[model samples]
Target: MMQLTTGERQLGAIVLIALAILGIAMAAAGRTDVLGIHGAMVLLYSLALLFLLFSSAFGPEPSPARLTRYYDDPIKVGVGLTLFWAIFGMFIGVWAAAQLAWPILNFDTSWASFGRIRPAHTSGVIFGFGGNALITTSFHVVQRTSRARLADQFSPWFVLFGFNLFCLIAVSGYFLGVTQSKEYAEAEWYADIWLVIVWVTYFVLYVRTLALRKEPHIYVANWYYMAFIIVVAILHIVNNLAVPLSFAHAKSYTIWAGVQDSMVQWWYGHNAVAFFLTAGFLAMLYYYLPKRAERPIFSYRLSILSFWGITFFYMWAGSHHLHYTALPHWVQNLGMTFSVMLLVPSWASAGNALLTLNGAWHKVRDDATLRFIMMAAFFYGLSTFEGSFLAIRPVNSLSHYTDWTVGHVHAGALGWVAMITFGSLYTLVPAIWKRERMYSAALVEVHFWLALVGTLIYVFAMWNSGIIQGLMWRTYSPDNTLVYSFLDTLLAMYPYYIARAFGGLLFLIGAIVAAYNIWMTVRAPSAAQLPLDEDLPASDRPLDGAAPTPAE
Candidate 1:
């Protein structure tokens, strides 16, 4: 367990007390105003304060002798929170989908509108689910690869709680109709500023840990994570450069305007995918895939090469989203060119993952976790390829406003991002908790199927609907007039929307089961624990005198 210093404990207690007081104030206001969103935030803040207070009073027992070197508490908390946010995010996602299919589900309330909750859902999953996963896994991977504990114990908790605090504020603001009108960057100036503070602390802590490494060389995964953290911070600050109307108001305006703003927004948007979603998860893939398969990476050289390649190419590729817009044609072409080039590095990483499993094919069949990682790799290749293709002007012409882009996004989001995360969590949760195995390997299998089938259903439905919509929009009548009205396309998409909602429901169910499995594993008797030797595969056992490598 983490041993907090006096200052750290005092800081934590003070923060909790502040949150509790804020919650009490919010609850009082909510009761008088009947403000649903404020009531929700009050509940969240109160429960969080209670949980922190309880944990501080009665912390987990100390790490056993065998685990003396590692710091696992932050990783454990992160994994649990990742599960919670994922389920919460996807639930909102499914509801949002249902509301689109049947608008009545919006309940005609401003707070419950699809517009309000859409950002909530996106932020919940992206920042809440994916962000926590990256932070937790980075801590785990960085420590293991460097052969060092995190540099500062309190910092990880600070990052975890501070980042989540920003997420909470962002989501609550969305429900309260406060935003900066940016797509993924919708969090208002105050939340954005808070995130900046939290993120800088995160970067300092990460570098500090790396500086303390006992290993001779830093691992490949850390490079990817470093890029993720650094680039995201840069992108976030630059793109969210907004001037608030007043300190008392949530409204703000971006520094850039018109075509420049459009360019900057997509520049930030696409790279959010590149950095926040792709690069960070790639870090997870690099560490977990080899460990789960009981093999070394196929090529450290390839990993390094691809890392540089992705970082360089992905930044220039965001302009593709601005194709055929008011932006200069030359800029669009530049984005298209770089996006296509990104395929090489993207595929290199995917190939490296698959090739690492050269002799572990049987493990993929037997180990559900390995299957998740392997499939994630496959889908990573597919998603990147599809991304490059869609970036082409001609392709974007058909896909930009259609559901095809939506399908493509999910192909990566669900197939690659969520899959790899689920895989890593399964591998991580057990090790962090010092469990012999998951409470139910069978349930992991169930999750794999549900996720796979759900993704297939979701993507294919969107693909079909998107294509139909696009073709209909482009079609001309015998006299060179439009063949179908916009409403016609909207009506055509209903069935597919219904289908997509069902798919989301399936995925949500799988996540719930996975959460339950994790909870049960954590609760399982210590008597069920196996020896360390029994937990590792024979092939994974370190040979005598072998120096510790990244996965080892």
Candidate 2:
């Protein structure tokens, strides 16, 4: 049997004992109507406990050396989970899109209904997939740049597993008709509390590791990650302020009502995009792009400038989501102005990314991973530009309540977020796994084309559909009367909706191919592991407790 650490043994014993008690309670509760959705949750938790025990009893033995350890195990697990959730989330997204196109795909079941699964799809992709990518990459990048092992071994594991636990609860609750009704903040109060606990631990662990860094200055990537952590905590707690109806029922009501609630929700929503999608991924981009290109960043000062600009500008931009509604006119204008101004920093970073590749365009041609990052940078610039345009009051009037917003989002989500993420993973996976390269670079080329083609199809379809809908809605029939009924708009959307679904399916396929390639890479017979000291340039890998080295 593997020797478990004192913490591991205690944790395992607690879980084992807790599961035994909960299993009995849940078995009784199953016979009662009051247990509700928790009965199912109880069974799941019990099963999880069983798996925990099996692993605790029989998993690999603990290593003896602490300082010499690279802390790659949890990161490796996080990478695998990232791929799994990406497939699961994108698959749900495809299904939800099809329901829009065909309507009959809902099939009259609550779980299958578009209303229920739409949240599932969003949560799966955004929180499940994207969130995991951020956490895992942060773990990997922090150690590499800081050149310190994580502060506590077990705490990192707890952060990863605990966050995933919250994801599971949020996803399951959505399917079970348990929600708080806020867009992107739908997980009920209990899940919200659970997440707060996990997030605080994550924040602490991150700070602790940074404190132990051997280098004098904290790396730029850590700055973005730190901002993401701090700002997200503020947004989550403030926006999710609610009173639960009861502990037994997964239901809650927001503390704020009316316009105040609208303000709060968008504050959380827009920043979720800013911090979650943009900042975290931008941090990942900063680390991965230059590393892959084997060049120094184009301008470190520009990175510093862009980071501050995005951090300051995005906080006020959420109110743009509530424009032309009950939100005050000045607040609406404030959001529009800030959002439009955001284009400067946004393009600055994008241009910075492209310029880093000044001498590496040839590598971009041969290396699909570089191609993914390059395309991601281009799309990041394009999407941020589109976002600024849409934030203008008049443009918002046309794009608001139309599929145009959806197209814009997919452009960022698929184009910027997913594309860069795939690029990073391709760069990181083989290196961490001690492989010369991916199982097949050929498959990577196939995936890049599939993802690019899919994103183009999806974005153009929504763009065309949104403009048509906007034009139809505003068209006057000679006397300032509405020319088209709402059904006419719905009718007009079928072809575009079909195209969107097809595009999503193609993206999903590309993700699966990537996942399979990663699996094969991990399982392939090891070509001797690369020495940690030699894996990166000496400037990039500072020794713990040593002074930093100058970059070439």
Query: Model 2: per-residue lDDT, tens digit, 1-552?
Result: 133566675675575467457545644544433234554565576567557656666556577774576678778989988998999999999999999998899888888889889999899999999999999999999999999988877677767877887788789877877778899998978678868987999999999999999988888999999999999999999999998765554567889999999999998999999999999999989999999999999999999999999999999999999989999999999999999999999999999999999999999998899999999999999999999999999999999999999999999999999999999999999778877778778889999999999999999999999999999999988888999999999999989999999999999999999998888778664435433456687665534432211111
RMSD per prediction, one decimal? Answer: 6.6, 7.0
With a 3 Å backbone cut-off (N, CA, C), the pairs that clash in candidate 1 are none
The worst-scoring run of ten residues by lDDT in candidate 2 lies at: 543-552
Number of clashing pairs per prediction, in order = 0, 0
RMSD of 2: 7.0
Task: Tell me how candidate 2 scores on lDDT.
Answer: 0.87
The 0-to-1 C-alpha lDDT of every candidate, in the order given, reads: 0.87, 0.87
**TM per model?**
0.90, 0.92
Steric clash count of candidate 1? 0
